[model samples]
Target: MPQVPIVAAHWVYLLGVALIVLTMIWRANVVVPSVLATFLVALAWTHSPIAALGSIFNASFTAAKELFNIFLVIALMTALLNALKVLRSDIRMVEPFRTVMKDGHTAYFVLAGITYVISLFFWPTPAVPLVSAVLLPAAIAAGLPPLGGALAIAIAGQGMALSSDYVIGVAPGISAKAAGVAVSAAAVADRALVLSLITGSVALLLGYFAIRKFITKPDDGLLERWQAKSSNGELARIAQEGTFDKVELARGTAGDQTPLANQGQIDKALAAIPDAREKWSKIFAVVTPLAFLGVIVVMVLSKLGIGHDLKGGDAAALVGGVAAVLMIWASFVTDPLREFLDTSADHVTEGFIFAFKAMGSVLPIAGFFFLGAEQGLSAPILGVPAAQAPNLLFELVQAAQHWIPGNQVFVAFGVLIAGMITGIDGSGFAGLPLTGSLSGALAPTVGLDPATLAAVGQMGAVWTGGGTLVAWSSLIAVAGFARVPVFQIVQTVMVPVLAGLVTSTICAVLIWH
Candidate 1:
């Protein structure tokens, strides 16, 4: 087959990607550069300013369309969590777990384990709220520092569970599809699961040790400190708005209006509930976890070939459907039947708002990357026929193969670095296709298994951009919930995440080859 020529447009795309990475490293927003890069690359490729302008808009539109399912899943899961909160079942759900988490060490692992499990079924975007709201407080109260609690959630949920994405299969699906691999995403998913565990374990252990010295004895004083900090922070915001009433200001002065006050009120209300209603809360709490457990069991059986496999979007749909049903059930239990509809609607709206707040900035960034992918949507936007559509990133990698060493070690690390660079935009899944495509293209040349290469890239991308290393990513959500500065969480996890990625990449080259 004749080699496709790399054009100036390809270099422009590379420059754009490089610039974006540089901006991220500088802790700056990359959106404007991404948008500009998209325009420049499109202009170079099509040589039409009109086409390039349209491509910018088309890129974001395509990204939103491609990733809307992720947004929907996040919304549904958040809505479900909110509904559970209404019945105080969210508290009930984690109350038992708190009993076993008696100290800082135990609390850290327990928090991580629960966050991992929940995040595996529902992506971390949704799982964060549930874990943060319930488990975070309990973990802190059990002697874990707030930053420690945030690290656990970030490592387990965003770094570990999302990187694997075995249950939902979204991450692997993107990779497999982009790679044009004949194998099902299940093949990649299995490998990713193992790699994610390896990475998560190393990172979590390192993280725990790094913060263990800061772990104080189980005391109310630590919790009070965090509460006072949160209250003072809120008071500052209220003061800036100049909206505080005298009574509110006085309450804030006493640090009595802490964020946990809402939870306290909910606990009081739960206590005041009729015995029948209260039983329902406990029942839903138990039932909710079991329902999700059942889903996992079914998926596991399917993975073992006992039943049909749930792949890609289907798996996400299964999770979303389950969450929706649970949301309705919880809403009905918590509110009058007539009000349940409104209650559910309110929850769903709130969930979408939260989802957008967390992820709205990702769309344009995803768009820029999507344009470099061979996803069919980009070709038309660039005013090229499907057959002639340029995959700028893939072509650049392909063209550079001659000069690039063919060693498997080099190839594996290259793919890992590429994935990490793509992850700079903070949507870990967004870059999977680019990494997957590169892995597929380069694996043959390097004589490595494409699946292994894909898995390696997945680890680097997710562990960095998914949340652990990047404060602008979903790590912020964990930070917010833990009431710590986002950068503090990033600093805490940086060494572990980088170490984990390096160790896992070496392992992938050695074990898989």
Candidate 2:
């Protein structure tokens, strides 16, 4: 690739960063700025009005293509979660864990631990409801505040665990792509693991004490007090009422349909009916976990020189394939052959619906960032380069690297902080490639492992933007789901998040150095 002149495109890149920062400071969505910046940058670079128009479409579409895999994983996992809910296995899966949630402290750690593991495997969007639905009530019952439950999950799943992205590989894929490194490279994965653990551990400990101070003894009167103060009581009541209505309808239908049937026949059918859900659910719960575990085992074995070599998309394929098989098996066990087709279709449709609804806005937002990478978009920003394709952000980072010393600690912390600041835009992922590239460039100067610094940067960017500390980030979704104030979530998360970042940064300096 030929080097493109930085010139006007450099200023355009700075302007985009400014626009993003300004939007973030105002707690507004960065989507508009991203789109407008991509267009203007492309327009200025190409100087051809026609090309500018085309770049806008190209940037967004290219980004969508690049990120579609991530979108699919989220969708499939969500679909799987919803399916589990329908089978009621979602509830049963966590029932045993309730026994461990005997106190606020216990509940706090348990929720965090469970969320970290599950989200590590499936991603947070899908894992949220499962943790909330089953474990939340248990945590509340064990004297953990609803806010505490929320805090634990955000720290573990959204912040620490997701920052690394070991199993799903979404974060790594994006970071590596931006850094011009190979996916699954040792440097990126290893460093990401270390940094993520440091941050997550710190965040978890800080959150524990904050909750401890607020925990009330498990008194009967406390439930009433909490209900009185509960911002979400009405929502819960409405949901409960809706559930009751469904139960009532099922009972009425059973009564009406059973009339004139033999008592023995009716008894046998009713006995078998509950068994259908129970039997199939048991099979699915047992089979799904085992199947997923088997895939992981196979993947590990393959990495170690067994079976078949799996590369890009294979990891996702393994997960999706297993999920599909489980979906089919569950459908079959629940109904006869005739019903299986209908059930499968219904579930897949539901999965897609859930997937799109939750993530529709993200694609366009991602497209805007994706625009930064392409020459088609750059032509619109910086007049025609004879033969060079401009990388706006990467060029900016490289130009500025000389001003900053390659102090390993400083670079790691600086990148981490820059990532956290970018996350203020509430789109944690928008600037990863820039950070990742910068990390790689700076790493050689600092005598540091580029991957480790990149991973540290990844941690800061993701944890903040991914919803742990930022009120305006996806924390809104968590607040909405938990029926708590979004601002309160931010307040509760601040100490823990800061603690996590500091610990992770210190760990990087000490251990990696």
Candidate 3:
């Protein structure tokens, strides 16, 4: 890598990273500092306050554009859930799972096993919301804490399956190309798979032990207690679909947000509900699971024997599309055909509102980090040509590279640390090239195999940036599902996840390297 000019923007970006980390340490929301950092970085880079001001919106817009799929999945999944709620099918859908998930311990492993398998083929981005929507309720009812469920999903799906990317081979392909080694991409992917499982196992084991304390014994109130925390836009408020806190049926309105006009409309709408609610609920409970199971089956088949052609987004798009269709169908079932349009629109609108409420804060924070990434993700935020954009994060990594010793284990762990740093940008794969290049260069000098070193770096980069440890990453999806703050998810998984990464690197040096 060529020497990147150390500019004021670099310093500002570093300061911003520090401020956000400190705010997190203080248990405060990091959004303010993140927005401030983006502004400062822009001012330093452009030397114009006007340009800096525009950069805030630009940064957030860029991040939102990149992460819109996540927003869509959340919205559609919620819409589906809302529709099911009208039919009372949502409860029925998860009822059977309560049988399978007899306890919190059983639910945790069940969540992990299912998440790992789905994420291995479908990618965790979509699978997290899908699984969270279907299985998470059941898991909670079975006595698993919402936070614990989120932990299981993040570690098994994002940290484990994503780190390896075995089914797709995308991550290994990037590393292999940057590695510039004689080794094939498949070879690197194979090694990465082994290392990933080791890391995931360690992380999951430690994570399970840590979260066990939060698990409560099964009881009817366990699920209700969790629901009580839900806001007006959440599943708990489905009964209040249009309105009625105190305004009641007298006005058929509750502030300006009410969708219906009067008691007549309310009664009419209620009357429109199919008399077969119980029967339809039973049918949908069976059909909903079958639909999702089929999606999983088809996704696995589509990707299994293919030559590394799958994209993480494909599964998300597929699931979102299916959820949308199901939601519309359920709407028609719940209301008269004339009211179907209104009801469906209401669900869609609420879905978007909830999605933004849950994930809107993530944009600016993610945008701040994106300004330090490579051109494709950062160029717009910087208002610079793609080729001219500075990869400030990777450049920082390279600036400190010389301090690493020429010892094998140190170099391996050094690459691991570097990978973790570059991963701070939140796109885990974005750091792969830098880590892979470092591995290729440092491994030969330190008596380490580039493939092994590259795999170690892959594990670190993906596990951290992919979701388990970062608030701005796809971990927000897990947070949204669990209805907890993203920082809580980060804090919960940090110790175990880091321990697992460290142990995996040590094993790589001792065994693979």
Name the best candidate (by lDDT): 1
Taking all chains together, each candidate's TM-score versus the true structure is 0.82, 0.81, 0.60
Ranking by lDDT: 1, 3, 2
Q: Give the TM-score of candidate 2.
A: 0.81
Question: What overall lDDT, based on C-alpha atoms, would model 1 receive against the true structure?
Answer: 0.75
By summed lDDT, the worst window of 10 consecutive residues in model 2 runs over 243-252
Worst 10 residues of 3 by lDDT: 244-253
Report residue 485 deviation for candidate 2 (angstroms): 4.6
For candidate 1, write residues 50-164 as lDDT tens digits. Answer: 9999988887787678768767877888798777766777667765676687899999999999889878865676567666655666678778998899889989998999999
Model 3 Cα displacement at 73 (Å)? Answer: 1.4
- Angstrom error of the Cα, residue 310, model 1: value is 2.0
Better of 2 and 3 by lDDT: 3
- Residue-level lDDT for 250 in candidate 2: 17
